[model samples]
Target: MRPIDEGMPRERTLLSWRRTVLAFSIASFALARLALAESLTLAESLAATALLVIVLIVVISMRLYRGSMSAVGVSTFIVSATTFLLGVIEILLVLKD
Candidate 1:
């Protein structure tokens, strides 16, 4: 792989992944807390499950692609798109309430 400016690009990429994981962690905990407080509707429960699955996918992909920049980038893109989709699902849940 071509090195770029003393690994700044790599650092940024890792940081982005860290941010995504942290955000997903927060969302997962929130969902868990909500689930404990009251019964969630089918849609909400599905959303929570999907969110968890996406989190696992992201974590696994990141680990698997640690040595490959292009592979990690593709995984990041997929994870990002799914995260946005989850956000939309959350919005719908709020609207339905």
Candidate 2:
């Protein structure tokens, strides 16, 4: 049987991860739009790659969250941080015009 309070924290964490995914999706869409407007092939490719990485991170994060593994949670946080950094880089590159 699951503890009563456990669900609350887990649910909150999951919601935060979902928000992260949504934010990344919006950023990726904006980057794509900017890339298309300026004919930036490299920016487009980098943004796509970052978006894919974010998707992969979200998948791993879901698994980690479900399993309640602290070790994997740390790894997920690291992956999310790196993915965010990559997304920032993509945005910067796209705006470097």
Candidate 3:
């Protein structure tokens, strides 16, 4: 295959990754912003903290963009897992209250 053909697939994949990052960043920021205004119980406070961590991860991801795709994918997974944990924390807080 030509050099241009090889780069085309990688370029498309990178574009898709950028879109995913943008979506995740927007969603995470909105969630964190809304969570900030809530009156908190201990669990809720921790959940808010986790949400903030995800926001931080998003910021760090931008800095590391030129590094490695593997590292970026790992960070994405961590943020996603943290998001899941935050959901669980919110659910428990609801049950506790």
Query: Which candidate ranks first by lDDT, i.e. highest?
Result: 2
TM for candidate 1 is 0.55
lDDT rank order: 2, 1, 3
- Go through the candidates in order and give the clash count of each: 0, 0, 0
Worst 10 residues of 1 by lDDT: 31-40
Best by TM-score: 2
Whole-structure CA lDDT of model 1: 0.63
Better of 1 and 2 by TM-score: 2
Between candidates 1 and 3, name the one with more favorable TM-score.
1
TM-score of each: 0.55, 0.63, 0.48
Misplaced by over 4 Å in model 2 are 1-3, 68-96
Q: What's the distance in Å from true for residue 50, model 3?
A: 8.6
Once fitted onto the true fold, the runs of candidate 3 whose alpha carbons sit more than 4 angstroms away are 39-76, 86-97
lDDT of 2: 0.70
Per-residue lDDT of candidate 1, residues 20-49 (tens digit) = 677776775565555443455654665567
